[model samples]
Target: MMTVVHHRTVDVGGQAVFYREAGDATAPAVVLLHGAPASSFMFRGLIPLLADRYHVVAPDLLGFGYSAMPPVERFDYTFGALTDAVEGFLDTIGIRRCALYVQDYGAPVGWRLALRDATRITAVVSQNGNAYTEGFVDSFWKPLWDYAEDMTEEKAAPLRGALSLEGIRWQYTHGVPDTSLVSPDTWMHDHMLVSRPGSMDVQLKLFSEYPTNVALYPQVQEYFRTTQVPLLAVWGRNDEIFGPDGARAFRRDLPDAEVHLLDGGHFLLESELPAVTALMRDFLGRALPV
Candidate 1:
């Protein structure tokens, strides 16, 4: 494992955004946006492979990893807020354009960026990120929507508690064919992020807002179709949460997108990094005109 060589912070809309960067500074920029629960650590294995060829930037989203976590009263963890935070982060970094590798919760932030600043996106590589109703399994998420519908301080505590270490481990390894692959450090890191003061609240609030994305997926797909940018869907065939169907459906909106399905779970890149990294390199070569 390569040690973290650089760390920095930039204020984005009054919130301090923390990010770690590795690899060549002069190479083409590639931003790795991680999903919920996991931080930039999701790309631990893949970063080294691309760092030699690309300047890789990975940040712990608002409430994840080393980033700031204001209370729910102070920071709304809605999809809009998440998008705006990333937009501000990009502006602060002076990244006019970048190849975006988005995963899970990253879909909302990346989609928002693609729509809000279409010209700034060079290429899009998505892993298990969806932009259509068929991509979602409502049954898996119905309880969350129901909780949000009747949210209250008294009832929300249980939801917050559910993000604990044990809860996180369960969610992370849930439905995986081989649970032994999930490392202790992975669960430890994710649990640490959620268990932070008020961070759990932010996560739960974000969970509640998931329904909004379900309703807004059509808009995201339309934005992609309109932008006509290069898109790739690298899916984990074994993902229990978000199925392969989501990856297939992405092609409906992005007819030109390149799709690859691999044998892994929601966290495929962790288990299968080399193959994914090669796919990313190939995708970038095809998507970005030199």
Candidate 2:
């Protein structure tokens, strides 16, 4: 468990960004970036494992988590802007080189930083991160994509309902093998994130901005091929959202990339932390260790 050590704020582009850090500062850094509707709390369980040997840091994205959201007008909330924010974060903390564990929305954030600072990345451990053309499962994302394409107040807003606590519980267990593990508090917390004032609007707009990333997928693949950074993909075999096809696709761009499709769904990290953490530790030890 992560013992609260007073939430510290960092200045990123004039925004007071909040984050949680653990372990020895002198150790090689291992930063974890979370996805939509989630805060750094997503990695709370895994932090202690990595913290024992590596400096671990996890941040709530600008508009998500406990971090400050300076109105949509002040910030674009697009991937380009987020990538720049993360770059500034690295520079502010003076992390010359670090290994990144990316999940969900973190896929784009980490990839954006990877493309810009490929030389600075020593290793990457991705849990359900996007890569290759196959990873883009059209059918699974069709509903959300359609909503983003044609958002309106009257249209069937499954995506909108899906962001709520009740909806999130279903999402976390739609095709999951272990429904028993879907704790009430988990859904409640995740729901609380998207339910905050302006949070729903933030998510809706971010959904609209997702197409920009879809358009830039090709560039992301090229970066993986060109950078040749040590990469590993740990995906939940039963992920209804991202699907298994996406996991196989990582090999097309990264032939040497290692992949592990474990038993779980979208939020696989929550179910398979021990396995994921072990894989990350082994990979980081060889590729980016102190």
Candidate 3:
């Protein structure tokens, strides 16, 4: 039987937030937060798979996918602001507690939620969602790091290429042993939305503020140690942006943290969906039982 997935939108702080929902609302809630250059659309495959056992909700962050893209002037594009929107969205929708599946940009947002109210997060499943200083690949982040130190058009100019169609394509294909597994639709869809007027600026603003997430690594690790929230790190071992070190680092804080390094790249779902889904089902079953 096919699990029915619903596409819906709701108002969160006057902004139209779009989300994909599945399974019964009464089931244990599992919230999926997508990374950069992707939206709830990234989880299209995973949602249905998890819906059979868990109530799954994947939302497009304010500036990504079908969600409202308020200009930088009106909305601060920092991760903190994004986290606020997600927090409010959860409150408005009555998801008091949920297991968070975070990736890339979603890490900061999800971690921030955990920081705000430790009781709200039932478990954490980080898929290339980094929260450690050692997780970053210097070669990949050097340019962005420079831009962070000196916020200027010149510094930001070179980084804009990353949001280009070609760059987005590379993001999806890179580190994957078999590029054929990555669908063109993934990058094309991302490029279309990212190329929108002022979208680049919005992305850059978030990029510049990424260091803030790095700064909070200690606090996040502390939460991991003290609260000892259920944690599972299912990472793409070949991801260059956030290497395997980040995944293994989780064990430093939570010695019992379950870590699985898969033979895939950044967008593991594209190449290893079944494997990832199976791991998640097992982990969530143990952490947040139905």
Candidate 4:
């Protein structure tokens, strides 16, 4: 049967969680978690590619994408809360087990799920997801560290630019050699979604608490050791935020993991979609076959 994506939302508890799904329900599931300043929208091109075989599900985290963006006072925007909502969403959607593909902010969200219940996961695809301290590079980490130290609007505003057009543009262009390969709409669309009411605050909340995720890295690594989970790390070598070191760090625990450093920036699918899809398909076939 031909594969097609369906943009849908499910009520998890009282909040609205929007997601994209495709493929037959009984097929093996693949959960794609996007990074900060991005929602399931990032998976648009890749969803149809994988949906032909596996059940692909990409959901917008709370306060992201088409999901309901409640005020900070209304919904605490922490990693814990985000995971709670995601796990609940999984239950509500009736997804019992699946492979996880996590990137940037999706790293922490996806790792939390793996740590919470290892049995629910079939395999892991780490795309620029950092699970080790060695992965923390200067260019991206320093500024955020400084911003987290001082919460003043002066510091916060520039940091907030990450949620703005210029920052989004920077993320897509900086590390890429062929600038033309990156699309302007990548940032433009994200800029529109993030500009929604109280959206920046939600991202800021996550920025402020990034250390918490870092603090739990040891545990995330431990879960890998105990579960011996199969892993496939496909990283965009040019990613300024998550340097190549972060991508290679997975081998520390899962030495048998398949790792690939692609020729692109933070958002690989933006420039190297076809290559990534090929690698992911091959990896899941060998490492996570149903």
The CA lDDT of each predicted structure is 0.80, 0.79, 0.93, 0.87
The TM-score leader among the candidates is 3
Please report the candidate that would top lDDT against the real structure.
Answer: 3
Candidate 4 lDDT over residue span 164-215, tens digit each: 7888998888777788987788899899988887788888887888889989
Query: Higher-TM-score candidate among 1 and 4?
Result: 4
User: Cα RMSD for candidate 4?
Assistant: 1.3
Instruction: List the candidates' TM-scores in order.
Output: 0.91, 0.93, 0.99, 0.97
Is 3 or 4 the stronger prediction by lDDT? Answer: 3
Task: Give a tens-digit lDDT track for model 3, residues 1-290.
Answer: 98899999999999999999999899999999999999999999999999988889999999999999999999989888999999999998899999999999999999999999999999999999998987898877988999989989888876788778898888788899999999999999999999999899899888889889989999999999999999999999998889999999999999999999999888899999999999999999999877
Model 1 alpha-carbon drift over 4 Å, by segment: 1-4, 152-162
Q: Candidate 2: which stretches are off by over 4 Å?
A: 1-6
Q: What digit string (tens of lDDT, one per residue) describes model 1 on residues 149-258?
A: 88777656666655778866766676556677777788788887677777776887888888777787777878778877788889888776688899998778778888
Native-referenced Cα lDDT, model 1: 0.80
Q: Which stretches of candidate 4 lie over 4 Å from their true place?
A: none
- In model 3, the number of clashes is 0
> If ranked by lDDT, best first, what sequence of candidates would result?
3, 4, 1, 2
Model 2: per-residue Cα lDDT over 1-290, one tens digit each = 55433356799889767788887878898888887777787887788788878888887788888777767766788878877887888789778888898888888888888878687777888877776556666765777778776887644377787786777886677666778866666678888877878877778778878877778788888888887778888888887677778887888878888889999877776778788888888888888756
